[model samples]
Target: MSPSPPLPKERRIRWGYWRSMMKIELTRQNVHNEFAKKVELISGQNLFACYQCGNCTAGCPVAFGMEVGPHQVIRYTLLGLEEEALGVNTFWLCASCLQCTSRCPKGIDIARVMDALRTVVLRKKERKDHVRIPEFPEGFLEKVPQIAFVSGFRKFLS
Candidate 1:
């Protein structure tokens, strides 16, 4: 038999007092360049390259397990929703296998872009107390290998 149909893209709180489906109300004032520009600079991938065809998400091995897939990450990143993109499991769960990059019609290196996003959020001084950056803490540092240690510094450090 065919696999069961997927759930709807949007959802509602029918039982609760909240009656409307969740919506992203994009205010004109909220749109800004700070986040997306940094991601593009770090990844060296143009946001203009993406046309939202969902190829990256479809080819991702871990997409099924991610709270946000590669495509949504790109969309959210471009939309300047840095917190939303950074807060998701998509970047952490990515295997860096390059399946999404290889399959992209836009020739975007989505995996690298995800890494760039990770770098931006992890390196933010203001966010340190809230998130556990894998690079920090003495016990965590010594246990992590040299390659990982160096790579983390290179990726996240300015």
Candidate 2:
């Protein structure tokens, strides 16, 4: 009947088309090489296991002052914006109280991530201007030896 409508033309499937689509999507999303690798490294914490329960954010003491908060920091890292993640004052201001880590549903050591970010920032020569904590506070260097001895004595007793 009417040659069965000439049998509808089959849609062409091209592997190259799929690849190009993927590339376009990634680029549109601002995803790049550095972000990919950084996400993989940070995922070692099993953060992908996180379900965004918000416990880490709720428990973080310095979350109020954070540019992106702990949860968003993890997300930024996962997205490969390592410099953006580490550049936040939150990384330096963290109290390291472990509350976020302890409360994490995925059991991620958030404190460890913070420490790792700080280490990365410290090792970068370009980040010297980003140093938040002074190596020696005013008048503190003059009493260094005395402070060291007292600290060492306290440690020995403990």
Q: Tell me, by TM-score, which candidate is best.
A: 1
Q: What is the TM-score of each candidate against the true structure?
A: 0.65, 0.57
- TM for candidate 1 is 0.65
Q: Which pairs of residues collide in model 2?
A: 35-80
For all candidates, the clash counts are 0, 1
lDDT for residue 157 in candidate 2, whole number 0-100: 24
Task: List model 2 lDDT by residue over 1-158, tens digit each.
Answer: 44544433343456875666554233534544565355446435655565677798898888888887777777666566777787788767777779998998778888777666665556567643542335547886567698665543332221
lDDT of residue 92 for candidate 1: 73
Best-matching candidate per lDDT? 1
List per-candidate RMSD values in Å.
7.4, 13.1
Off by over 4 Å in 2: 1-44, 129-158
Looking at model 1, which ten-residue stretch has the lowest summed lDDT?
A: 12-21
